[model samples]
Target: MRSSNYDKFPFVPVAAQADACQVGWAAIAGVLQAALAAQPAASGQPVVLAVECYPGTGLRQLRQALTQALQPARCLVAGDLYRPTADIDAMVAGPLTDDPVFGRLNGLTISDFFDAEKLRAAQAELAAAAGELVLVLGTGATLVCPDATVVVYADLARWEIQLRQRRGEIANLGSDNMAEKASLKYKRAFFVDWRAADRLKKQVLPRADYLLDTNDPTAPKLISGADLRAGLAAAVRRPFRVVPFFDPGVWGGQWMREKFDLPDGPANYAWGFDCVPEENSLLLGFGEARVEIPSINLVFAHPRELLGEAVHGRFGTEFPIRFDFLDTVGGGNLSLQVHPLTEYAFDKFGLAYTQDESYYMLDAEPGASVYLGLKEDVDFPAMVADLQLAQADSTAPFPAAKYVNEFPARKHDHFLIPAGTIHCSGANAMVLEISATPYIFTFKLWDWDRLGLDGRPRPIHLAHGAANIQPGRTTAWVEQQLVNQIQPVASGEGWREERTGLHEREFIETRRHWFTGLVPHHTNGGVQVLNLVQGAEAIVESPSGDFEPYVVHYAETFIVPAGVGAYTIRPHGPALGTECATMKAYVRT
Candidate 1:
């Protein structure tokens, strides 16, 4: 019920003391009434007043506030008009208009209003002396009386203060806005197959010597020797998956692979390197972890320095492309499995297929054959059905599928198993391990009932394999000079040679170094992924990148990032097959 000072001398106007008001309505009702009170009761000329007030929240207050102001006994003149000019002069003072807010002066929260028109009419009908008058009350509305008095009420100041305070949080003297980061990087690796591990270890693997720690007998085995041992879960009963970035000590939150439905097996399967208090780590697996006996580290990781910021959203740190490891173990005497092409991959996954893969011969018994392509006069449909029957039941007695090209695979031999090429590391006994980042969009054409560890029948992709199969070519093209050019590189004893290839994104160069004294050295650019073919009890260097050599056996995959470019390899004497030590290296291009 605050009020504006009343300045009057005539009619001894019982000073129109008013009730409490919101900052706005009080000014409107008070000023209008005061102007009418000052009017000459006998004069027909009504005093006009343009009234205004500061508007806050007082819609409900305005109705009751004005009603009493126009009481029959309390009013000499009433104040019930928004602009005083017009129909207001003819209406009852109770309320000049039915439209809520009384000409928009009050709001929807109205409780009551008095008729100033009623009083004005009463005065006129009773022949009471009173002039035609004008009254106005509004938010931010101003008024001018015949007496030359001007009244104004407005509130543009308070709101500005509230708005400014909210905008000052980003990089201000008081607080930080916490902008979100959009880009990320991490260290990663992938590999499979005993031979690939063999070819990888003696050669490029020595560079990642930082990952080996053979003396720790407790470490798990990659390619279980003649005596198979199980860990964590019973042999093959539980799902086994990739080991996340291994932390020699901590229990939970170690490897990235555990992030998905993948199962955890023995830590020694495929050991990866990671530091303590990890900034960020992610392990992803597509299906039940596919085993890569004698492994290769598929580096799907980023250097730690880059994973510095906190990841906020789910699926926030997604890889631009799929990261999958394909294994072609025990060449099934036929080239059968196949994957979709780039055009197909893009249509399905919204990106170009990046699974450029390569295979390393782990062990090729005499007369070992590799079907790199389909031979001339081969029929796609005939092959598809035969493959389906054989895969559904290894004893289906399918005929020998014609080979477009075959290569004599010896130990440590390597070949580019790029997309679209219908290739298979042939049987007699050879482990063709694969390395590629693209997820498998496979249509399994044949599985030979391969008898997964679970004893369940393996699935086949008859349609997809037949779709991508390229038939009608030479029977021995892999031995051609052009094809031989793409092989793995070797530099060690016992390992006859190194084969190599200029693979697309999924692969780079493969190093086939027959073991000697593999001293760890810095590999330029990205992580150096390693797979051990044979050997055990090897000495792995400490963080300083310096250590004494130790012994190690075959069939192990090691992942090492650019950071720990330090380590030394000391192979067990010849008695432990020193000449047999060998490995290959894969890096991001």
Candidate 2:
């Protein structure tokens, strides 16, 4: 019902002037041409330009643009050096397994994709092109010409890659399956393509001459690699936000579409990825131009500073905490599901940890409810049989209400869901999902007999869900352990803090603050993610003026890196004198 103040493209201002970034093909090409001209061919050999791209980056468009501008004597697509698509399909079949939604993590690198003979031949071809400009480009261009005169690393965000996959505009690396189902393509990218591509990107980004932002194929942006690094370094020193993306789902709702002022296209918006670094983008501002890069790059490049010593030591370069929105307002119920326990996750999926989560109800309708745990004294075997029968027959919907405990949900109610607990949020509720960031391991047991947007039955992993479901998590246990486990922790003159769980078994801890005045906060040597759950606007300020005051709007999530040390928040703008609330999550340690 409120006007949308949600910022769609949040960027960290990196430079005082705009000259560091070049926008559009003409501007970007001009910068590259100047760099090429400055560094002439050595020993009368060709000036080799290497455009190493992240998979799903539009290489064809990049080649055409740069070719027209630079007039390269020869341009080699890295795919030509790759083994046949059939061979790659066979090579990845084991890791990609036949699963529609899950796969083993691939250990392959970009080098493994190339044919040894073809690579050597390409090397020779580049060497023989004396006195002529040669361009080698694709996902493994740097590997093809390691000693190139200039290197451009084209980077695209994971969400953008997924959109491209959904549109059938791109395919996984070293494969010719552009027409594959988006979900299957996403599985391949998650388990195979991205893993291999990330290995190469880590090596190339730190030393590449330029960083290309290719999220928008029509208008690419270019910045020096040094500027990109500087932007990342600047980010960790302050409270910043990753660019959030919204996606529709089978049980999506209209809350976000109306509240976020999203265009009317998708039927509804289900997810708002507010702080998922692995799947979000971060924009770096250079005066007039903004360059988009995968938010994970910041986590990779500055884990110690951004995550703090303790968190970095535990998670390495990974950002373990995630904050996202799940809106089912004016929609249908979420699928009944369970996440794997830690041991099972590692044994089966190579995950070091599991997805232990908590759902904080941000808004709810009069009868909003959440399905959690199980019904007391329910027939366990009969429930499983019912689930199996439902899976087997489309017309028979699993009787969820008969076996699951439905708890009334209200605004600010936090429900703890440790791994192995059966749970789902009922429709007409907006949820702020805070969790450990192994997000894709969900095992759905039922989907209300609904078909997906692609007009096919959604995949159900009854065996996986049943194996992980804890039968002992019944009504009484859930009442005592999960529902609204809130305890008053501390208070100030105009503010009070309460510990809103995450069960003891979970690594993440959450807290809620109700304030009408300044509320002091510290990272305590670990990264903290927070959202202004109940306010029109609030200003986050550094106690020592280390960083500028950052303004966050209602339902907007932001991160305070451990490096930020101390900060304070207070209602600002329209919420200046009104009581406001914030929910914060961090690693338990």
Best-fitting candidate, scored by TM-score: 2
Which whole-number lDDT from 0 to 100 does residue 484 have in model 2?
96
CA lDDT for candidate 2 = 0.92
Query: What are the per-residue Cα lDDT tens digits for candidate 1 across 169-277?
Result: 1111111212311000000000111111123223322222112111112221111111111211121121112232322111112212331222356331121221111
Per-residue lDDT of model 2, residues 470-515, tens digit only? 9999999999999999999999988999998989999999999999
Per-candidate clashes, comma-separated: 89, 0
User: How far off is residue 125 in model 1, in Å?
Assistant: 66
Q: After superposition, how far is residue 208 of candidate 2 from its true place, in Å?
A: 1.2
Query: What is each predicted model's overall lDDT from 0 to 1?
Result: 0.35, 0.92
TM-scores for candidates 1 onward, in order: 0.41, 0.98
Question: What's the alpha carbon RMSD for model 1?
Answer: 31.3
